[model samples]
Target: MFPYRPMRGLDEGLYCVDGSFGRSPLGRRMTVLVLPSGRLAVHSAIRMEQADMAALDRLGPVGAIIVPNTLHKADAPWYAGRYPDATVLAPRKAVARLARRMRIDGTLEDDWPAELAAALDRLALGGVRMPEAAFCHRATRTLILTDLVFNLGVQFAGLSRLLLKLDDAYGRFGPTRLFRWVVLRNKAALLASLRELEQWDYDRIVMSHGDIVETGGKQLMRGAFASLGL
Candidate 1:
């Protein structure tokens, strides 16, 4: 397992594990949701040590594994191999790509388990080269994202910090300029999706690649996309 922090609670029935992102110190995170039925849903999974896995198992039986997008599918197979009974899920558009990495049992749009559906709201981002999905955990009003934005802060050092600074995402809560230039295909469509997300009642934002926005996330999101006139 790569260097990682042990599982820690984030909100009521919500948890996260922080770990290294490949060789970069930019970091990554895995969000864990304990459903109303006591089953666990893992989003953007990361390979963890046995102790951490045991800690996660103590929360509840792993019922679902969510690969939020193609870019975040690297660790999906690891989770699948560990929890063979867990249903692997991805966005409808991401299923085909994710299937090349692991067996995708269903899409988040239609095949999400009924028992787990009530705890969160889901959306598929539009007009991006790599299809991605976002979620809002209803009970905590936390918006969950993967690569939509980054908030690396000052934890990084040396080369990683320099690279992030070059990317214009080192110490901010916004999308990287690189992402805008490379991944985003249609600004209008992405802006439309961002507008739709504004309707969600979320105050906190938890993203895969950086620090969590504890409050005022809506305003931050708006400001982040203001350049695109959101």
Candidate 2:
């Protein structure tokens, strides 16, 4: 396993959860996101240890587990069970497919769903895979994301990490052109997700990777996506 050092991220009112990333059983890692309410969201949840669970409990109990997009299975049941009360919520369209592969049945909720309704502003980033949504919670001006975009660090392994410096994104936060160019399938949907993300009101961006964007984040994200012609 890689050293589990996490981002000691933004101290803003929004409790940004830190998820360590390494290789996944599926060949890519799945980063976990912890919500202020103590909820957990990740790609797959199998065998997530109790120590991590206890650490997250400090932020809040896992009210819900979000499987951001359909591609990853990190938020699986084995992981969800770590929190006795948390239920897994996935996108409406991906529910059945996820259920079949994981043997874990989850309830699909729209956008931030009803539970998160009070806290998030739902903007439709249509055409990108699912009806991608970018959210803004007024309490913290924090925007939560789902593959809608990426910003990797300069410290990761392989030649890809070195090239990341081209974006002027050195070992901290900001967009990773390499990661984006490789992962984004259907540029049309990616573009839509970007356009919608720009309209959101937020100063902090809580990503599933790298460092969190702290200030002028909205502008940073705008420039990040706009460069792709999204």
Candidate 3:
């Protein structure tokens, strides 16, 4: 289990757990946000050992567990078994698939509790064939995204680095060309989602696959998505 690193600031009631994805040496991050009610909201959970779970227990009770997309549920079942009372939420497209692996309490399209809604709001990404949800933390001016934008940069090596570079993925704050080609289905919907993101007034971005964008995030995101020529 990796250690959870807390971000600074009251509004930034977030912590990150870093680990590698599958056989890939590139790091992946899971976000944990402490809600206003003193309960924790965990996103893209990565399985943790008993000692690490004890560490998280020191922060607060787990209230919500989120699997943001279809590909990110590797640890959901573990979390669900650990926190039976916590709400398990996933995108509509992923519920059926995830249900086959573990239990899902609801989809993001359903209504949210006021306490949960007050701290974070979920937006459905309109462009892709596969469903994905983006979250914004109102008080923190932070946007949480999964797979929408990657910043793998130079951390990769050998063939992975070479492949990411060939895909226009390495050393960047935008979506790789290969990602766009394989995952993107509707340019207009994606552009609309980008326009909606501009209105969130986000100053920072927390990405699942890369470095967090700490400043000027709105403009950077707009410019990044614009590379699609949508």
Candidate 4:
């Protein structure tokens, strides 16, 4: 079975499951948001054991499954199959790409549920070739992201460690050199989006890959982008 940790609470009404990307040492995380209505919205899904699925079910019915970005669609099909009734959402620019793998009910830019809208603020990251999106959970003051930045740290070893270090993401909470050179197409557009994001009141960050930033997220995010002269 694909290895994954059971659901664990993080903040009020928020939880996460730790997993990995295929055989890679790069860690992946699935964030679960429980709306005030008790419905659940899953972000960047990971295939989990039956018991863990059961645990998720016990929390609430899965009302929405978010793909977040084009590259993060690996296990979205699995989640779509398991929660057939759940609306599958992806970034507007990613709908076509994600549709090649699974059914996409709507785009994150539009068609978001009222319950989800009430809990989180969503934004599409512009000037990036990868079609990524980011969210801020207002109640928990947490920012949710996928691939815009990485925080791999020193948890990895050997090749994985060396590669991450070379990428400039091994021991830092910032974007990799490759991400800046290739994935980032227009610094100005991304900078505008980041400026808007700065207005959000978030202290913690929950990203799909690597460890979550428990505090000082706003500062770290600003610093990450500032390095790009954005």
Give per-model CA RMSD. 1.3, 4.9, 2.2, 1.2
Worst lDDT run of 10 residues, candidate 3, spans 1-10
Best model number under TM-score: 4
Candidate 1 residue lDDT tens string, 1-230: 67889888989999999988768666789999999989999998988877778889999999999999888777889899989999998999888877886889999888878877789888899878888999999999999999999988877788877888889998899999888999999999999999889999999999988889999999999999999998
Instruction: Pick the winner on lDDT between candidates 1 and 4.
Output: 1
Model 4 has a clash total of 0
Q: What is the C-alpha lDDT profile of model 2 across 156-203, one tens digit per residue?
A: 555555544564445644444544555556677667766766776788
Q: Between candidates 1 and 3, which one is better according to lDDT?
A: 1
* TM-score, per-candidate, Cα-based: 0.96, 0.67, 0.92, 0.96
| Candidate 3 lDDT by residue in tens digits, 61-141 | 999999999888888888999999999998887789888989899988784666689799888898787778999988788
Query: Model 1 off-target regions past 4 Å?
Result: none
lDDT of 4 by residue, 124-210 (tens): 998899899999999999999989888877878889888888888888888888889899999889988898789999999998777
Comparing 3 with 4 on TM-score, the higher-scoring candidate is: 4
The positional error of residue 228 in candidate 2, measured at the CA in angstroms, is: 5.8
